[model samples]
Target: MKYDWVLFDADETLFHFDSFGGMKLMFERFGVNFTRDDYDAYQLVNKPLWVDYQDGKITADELKIIRFEGWATKLGITPFELNSAFLEAMADICTLLPGAKELLDALSGNAKLGIITNGFTELQAIRLERTGLSDYFEHVVISEEVGVAKPDLGIFDHAHQLMGLPCKTKILMVGDNPHSDVLGGINFGIETCWLNTQGVQTPAGIHPHYEVNSLEQLRMTLFA
Candidate 1:
């Protein structure tokens, strides 16, 4: 392996982040029939919170509780209760991306593995254990625990410190988001691979060291 430490982004990189589906399932438990229109309405409130979160304008707990504020009001529950319900729903539905298991299996011994996720601390541990992924990783650094999100230097710095500060060239960061994972790694002086699963054009002003269409392709690129 070319790298000593391999760090990954969680949602949409390793696990499927089916927010709509999870919301539907969660609302069903609360006796609400969630529709596509409902999802659109939800995103109007939810999406910006994520941007604010990654930008360090909001704390992880704030984003989690605030996103469900309207729903909590309607359901006669606290926002934290609704958020926990949604996360539980998400955990129940969590699955590895198609090639994620295979790639991790191959890298298990050859490279040290860790997760750097902007995802909620509540959801990550449950899903990792549920999916049998917990043992594969040496560390699971969470924004909620670290007090900083990705694309920020603080979270990456924390992960590096926990890693015993490996040489920048001997570490590789991989994720689906070009902005957070690719740009953050590049700025932090580590090698990076962007997992462009949807084949979208790279957004202007950011570039990753490598790009691949899928985890299988990433696996091949790393080991070929």
Candidate 2:
């Protein structure tokens, strides 16, 4: 392996983060039928909160509560209660992406592994444990715990602290989001790989050291 430490982003990078499925399951418990239209409406609130979170404009707690506020009011529940239910539902449905286990197995002995995610603390631990991937990582830095989100150097710095301050050049970040994963890694002076599964155009002025369409491709590239 080219890097001594490999950091991964949790959602969509390693795990299948099916927000719609999670929400549907969560709402089902409350006797609400979550439809595609409901999901679209949820995303309208949720997506911008994620961007705001990555940009450090809002906190994870704020984002979590605010995104569910409308639903909470309608359901006669607290936002925190609704948010917790959603996370639990997400963890229940969590599954690794295709070839995620193979890729991790290939890289395990060669590099120190870590997860630096903007995902909530409520889901990360349980998801990893339930998916049987908990032991693969040396660190799991959550923005919620750090009070700082990705695309911000503080979270990366916190991760480095947990890593005992490894060499910057020997660290590589792999994630699905170009902005939070690639751009943040670039800004932090580390190598990065963007998992461009959708084959979307690379955003302006952001670049990754490598790009792959799937974890299988990444495994091939790394172990070739």
Candidate 3:
């Protein structure tokens, strides 16, 4: 393998993060039918919170509460309660992305692995354990736990420290987000692979060292 350590972004990179489905399941528990209109409305509030969280303008706690404020008020529940419910629902439905298992299996002995996720602490552990892929990773760094989201170098620095400070050239960060995973790794002086499953245009001047359409392609790129 070309790299000694490989770090990954969790949601949409390795796992299928079906937020709308999770919300629908969560709202069903509250006896509310969450419709597509409701999901669109929710995303209006939720998506920007993620951007803010990633940009370090807001903390994870703030993001969690603010995104659910409207829903909490409508449901007559606290945002904390609603957020917890949503995370649990997400965990219940969590599944690895296509080829995730195969890629991880192939990479296990060749390189040390870690996860650096902007996803909540409530869901990360359970999702890993449930997926039966927990043993492959040497470290799991969560933004909520680290108090810094991706695109900021702090979280990557923290992950590097946990990795015993591997050489920058010998490390690779992989994720679906061009802004966070690609830009962050580039800024941190490490190689990066953007999993551009949707074939979105690369952001201006934020180039990744590599790009692949899927984990299967990544597996081939790395080990073929």
Candidate 4:
């Protein structure tokens, strides 16, 4: 393998995070029928909070509680409770993206594997365990635990320390987000690969060591 450590992002990069589907499922238990319009409206609130969370403007707890506040009030529950239910529903529905398991299996013994995700602490353990991918990673670094999100050097520094300070050249960070995953890794002096499954245009002022459309393509690139 070209890299000693292969660090992955949890959502989108490896796992299929169907947020709308998860929300719909969660709301079903509460006797609420969630619709696409409802999801669209929810995103108006939720998306900005995530951007703020990533930018260090708002905290994970703040993002979680605030996003669910409207729904919580309507349901006669706390925002934290709604957040927990949403995360639980997400974990229950979690699945590996196409070719993710195969790609990970191919690299399992050759490289040290780990995850560095901006996702919350609530979903990590259960999602990994349910998917039987918990043993594949050396550590799953969560921004919630680190008190810093991606695109910030602090979180990458924390991940590097947990990795026993591997050479920057020997580490690879892979994720779908250009700003957080690609730019952050580049700034932190490590190689990065953008998993551009959407085939979207790369934004200006950011670059990655590699870019692939799918995990199968990434596996091929690694061994090519």
Of candidate 2, the 10-residue stretch with the lowest lDDT total is: 52-61
Worst 10 residues of 4 by lDDT: 202-211
lDDT of 1 by residue, 31-143 (tens): 99999999999899999999999999998878878988888999999999999999999999998999999999999999999999999889998999999998999999998
Q: What residue runs in model 2 are displaced by over 4 Å at the alpha carbon?
A: none
Count the clashes in each prediction. 0, 0, 0, 0
Error of model 3, residue 164, in angstroms: 0.5
Q: Which stretches of candidate 1 lie over 4 Å from their true place?
A: none
Can you give the lDDT of residue 85 in candidate 1?
Answer: 96
Q: In model 1, how large is the Cα lDDT of residue 173? A: 98
lDDT of 4 at 197: 98
Residue 152 CA displacement from its true place in model 3, Å: 0.6
Candidate 1 achieves a global lDDT of 0.94
Tell me which residue pairs clash in candidate 1: none
Q: What does the lDDT read for residue 88 in candidate 3?
A: 97
Could you tell me how far off, in angstroms, the CA of residue 105 lies in candidate 2 after the best superposition? 0.5
Candidate 1 differs from the real structure by a C-alpha RMSD in angstroms, to one decimal, of 0.7
Candidate no. 4 TM-score: 0.99
